[model samples]
Target: MLPRTSFPSAYRAAPTLCRRCLLRSMTARGQQSRFISTSWLEKQDEAKRKWEERAKLIEEGKIQHIWDTFKDRGYVKDLAGTEDQIKELMVQKRIGAYVGIDPTAPSLHVGHLLPLMPLFWMYINGYRAVTLVGGATARVGDPTDRLQSRVPMKKTDMTMNITKIHYQLKRIWLNVEAQATRFGYEKEPRIWNRAILNNSQWYASLSFIEVVSRLFKGMRLGPMLSRETVKRKMEKGDGMSLDEFVYPLMQAWDWWHMFRKMGVRMQIGGSDQYGNIISGIESIKYLRDTEPDPDQKLSDDLSNTPIGFTVPLLTDSSGAKFGKSSGNAVWLDQFMTSTFDLYGYFMRRPDADVENLLKLFTFLPLEEVSEIMEHHNQDPSKRHAQYALAYEVVGLIHGLEEAATVQDQHKGLFSKGGATEVSSYPTGGPPTANMASAFRVDIKLPESLVLGKSITRILYAAGLADSVTDANRLTQHQGAYVGGAPGQPAATNRGISTGELTFTPIKNWFPQDTRNFLVDGKLLILRRGKHFVRVVEVVSDAEWEASGMMYFGEPGTGRVRLLRDALMTGAKEGEGHDLSALSSPEARRDFLDRAEALYSDEAGRFKGLPSEAFMVKKTRARQILEQSFRVFARSGNQSAQAKTAAIDEVLERAARNLDGHVENYMAEKKRQEKKKIRTSRPADEKSAVRWV
Candidate 1:
């Protein structure tokens, strides 16, 4: 089934012009509409008119462009197909190719896409394409590169993952089909005849004897043992199992299946999968020869059905295999990785990777991509190529409008740094997704903003502090900040709750002061520190106290008491001293001083503090502030100092602390240097030096 558009109205408005249609329309009418830019239309015309010329270039298999593209993008020698081999293949006729994706995980990662590109290119260039899902094979677990043995998947989980994967593939294939079909043959635009097939459909009904018979027919035991992936594991005493040994044979069977069922002649994937693809081709050759005349040669025309190609594994400029980001694999699902995070990841890709990624991922003309690359290389700070890559990928996957939305939100969150710039709605309404990473929702302020709401109540309502005491400790440490402004003193424990708080990039947003609050447009994102973030909105008191609600505010009194008790209990258990110990004014002052030190030096001591010990101290201060609420009620007026001055003080203090740390380190280095000199002196001279 074709993938359904999430928003049909969008396609209706735009008329869903595929590349082929656009090209044909331009050639026949000799006019370009706004939707079909004049330059883009001209380029399409040129490419279509001169298809044979490029075909010859491809036929000659001059791989300079392909090599340059891959090399610039950080790929080195590929696992199987070399630069020379790919060049030779390109000179050949339109190939029928297949890429097998095993739904080992619920979703495909960016790593998987690297290998999928060769098949995609084949489809785009008028070759038949097939995407084979390993629903049957997933249960067997292809033990190729795994260091440790993986637990076999349950049939149920494997089925579910495959279903989800099938849906994702449908979306990707449809998008690719639209682009690929549009790129060539404008008069009779070819529709991509892509298939998402389940191997289980073909293999499930086969008996064990049948499977065994086929498995041994084309399989070679010696070559299987000789495979690098298998040999290395065996040499390391990892003990390759029979199933692991038979993995290539089963994979080969997939190619053979495609060859027979779909008349697919080629198998393309990552270099790592070369063994499997080659094996599959051999299996097909063996099966065809052994079978009857009509089935012996599946294709009469070699040009249309010629087989086998694989793309190089994508990597970064550092040669690190391209898949992991911040130690996690970059998944296609929004839930797995935010759109913004995805964009940001692509946006920061090295120049080398950008050129190759464009060839692999984007349908943008090679010439235009090259132009972008040239400009990007000239001035990398502009990040034109990265942005282009980000734009194209996001647009292809999520659509142009969604991509645009994500880009805008990225600017607002990172560039502007607060919720005021974003659209504010009541919380519980549908969330606004940006760059596919962050979500914006409506958040109502607590009654404390206008009313004489207590600090504990406000904190509780905002979900910042658990209890009044928890609020107090966070406030005491200066850990909690509203709209990038520090909270008031702890004496007046009544928290003034506003309807919205935004999670903006405050400290890291260009530059800022101790407090620079602006309700940019409508959104209110509050940043607590380098990491803690909250996005919220303000609402009327009636809304704050409303009942029969989906999301309601916490009761002011109960919240405060809960916070205070929680803090008190924590302090008693974690800290040696009880809350009563701080009853004396002098003791309270000392405790406050210690709290100040802890807060100021948090970054330095963050790693050293035991989790329980830190929580206890934080809670104790919170309880104190909650109990002595009156002390914190004083609202300090905002200083008229320049933003730079306010920010400079904090930056300078931090700098000085860092400088002091460096000085101590230097002194230690000097001590070590002197000791080394003394130790190196002759024995008699060393003794004399010690006496001196």
Candidate 2:
């Protein structure tokens, strides 16, 4: 170690300021050792002194208001400053702001709402709002979500997704145009002003030198290393590329450009973006052309610049993130999520989150929201809050008229007072039966959404299907109603169009989860009930012609590696020719074939491991192999039955060791029992049923 005298007294002394004080001071001063204003320093000290008092007030509801109430509804925390910052920003300058969207898909999803809310808030509050479409960024996919790197898109595909996303946004925001239909006018919220922008407009025009100068001038490696996200990845010994490391830098550059060009002063995104947000503020302060005065010095505070805020992840009742039910995303585009399906999803949100959902995603006033909350609390079984929440959000997204129509259709067929079943909807759609006033979606019947499901299952959900015999004869004797018609004499092999099907009941019941089935647009809705809708948006003709998936009939590059590995593994294990002998492409095809065979042979044994192992590769394989080894350790080579018995024993023991920590827990429990339960029967005897 260096001599003690080498260190300064300040370094040796314990820190006088608390962490929050330090954070504030650092944010205020930012790299400067010198203080600016005496009052500012005093304010910091006061904040420290009164921290507990302010926290108590915040907890006790003294500071509660519309904004605070909104925050409680899942609005992000740690937005630059307190209420003082908001007042100051409003007084100082009319801040211009933006939210970024990458045109990676044809539609938006509910997940994208987090940033959109802030953009709307800024727009409504006397600030200029800009919606930045990342036409350029979409081509080079953002690494935020993907574990592996994304394949760079062709310029044409990028252009198409960008155009598609633009239209979807217009629908979401209810953009006004000459072609605006009733759906656009009556349902969707009109939030944006005149400033819809594409970052490609600026980024495309920049020279290489200009790009470098703007992005790299003051960015050093030290700060990058210190970032929590980066540090976490490095500590895990995971492979993080230069691009992954530099991604935040690129995002920071985007903010700097916006700040300089549009006077944008705030950035809001998911919690994952905190590092990028901080970097953006740093870039704005230090990289701008205007320099600080000779007398002025940098302060430590980071909160004084463009504000950074992040919302918590949305989760379902089971405490898992929303859209994680089956490990698939519920996309916002009509092709990805149907309007009716979307409505039903919001309907299923837990009562605990109704207020948060409204505050985060809707424009409901505080008083109305409170009333809805009270109604929900009074009789949760009534599902009043669920319907209202779903109706308002779906109307805002798809249009009020459509929502009303869906509701009317639902009531006509399913309501107890209405018809008990629906033979068919007037429009060409699914032949639905057993409709209910009480809305419930079927995730498995998009084909039958209003048309195709057997009347029995529809009635089953609606309490109509009583037994197998009742269902079988109803179809056998042509007694079943379909699209307002009696069942066909025999099951036909030919495919039936939507118009051809007829229902017997003829009463209207809203299409149970009919949200995905769009009637007019080329995009068709397919529902798996209320919860699962897949929107297949019509690709532009040009896009269709250019797509390899459309013309060549195959998935694109960078997706065949796993299939190839599987094939090779199967071949090696099966005493067949080596898959390695084939070219990479051929190997991939072979792997997919073998993998499919294996899947068909033993679905339960193969599905979980193959998908999981293929994705994570080496790490997961090692873990599984190690566990398997431990399980087989005591199972020596012997007759199949004896070996199997030994294996089973070892596995049970391992499971107990892994899941229950049985040995340690049992030892501790014995000690506790010996000390505490003196009069009881022997500890093991109570649980035992053994015979010697």
Q: Please tell me which predicted candidate would have the highest TM-score against the true structure.
A: 1
Q: Compared with the true structure, what per-residue lDDT tens digits does model 2 show for residues 1-692?
A: 32222223464344454555555655766666666798767765664445446445655678543245436666765564356665345334456667777776555666677677766655543356777777656655555534455566554345445545554565555422211343232222322233667766666556867656656767888987877666656656454677777777666767777776666777777666666777777776775533345443334333335765766676556765543223545665543565556666776778777777777776666678899889888889877877787776666565566556555554465332332222222123432211111112111222332243333444332322333344454445544333212333213212122222112321222443222222232223222221222223334545544553321111232123333344446564655554334435455444444544542343244332222221322333333323323323444423433434443554454354444443455566778777565547675875674422
Q: Let me know the TM-score candidate 1 reaches against the reference structure.
A: 0.49
lDDT of 2 at 280: 76
Tens-digit lDDT track of model 1 for 1-692: 33322334443334455566555655766554337578767765664555557666655665334434444543333333344554444444333567788887767778777666656655655556788888767766776666555678654345446545665676676556555555653332443356778777666555777657655855677777788778777877467887777777777777777776666766667766766766665666666655556634554333323346556765555666654322557777555666677778888887767887886787776788889999898998888898889887876665566567667776665452333233222234332222212222224563334134443334444554444565566556655554422343223222221221122221212112211342322223343333223444445567756743323244433334443354344342445545566656665655554553443344454343222222224454433443443333343423322322433454465566556655666677778888888778899886666532
lDDT of each: 0.55, 0.50
TM-score of each: 0.49, 0.47
User: Which stretches in model 2 have alpha-carbon errors above 4 Å?
Assistant: 1-73, 80-83, 175-194, 234-238, 289-304, 322-326, 412-692
lDDT at 340 for candidate 2?
56
Question: Going through the candidates in order, what is the number of backbone clashes in each?
Answer: 59, 56
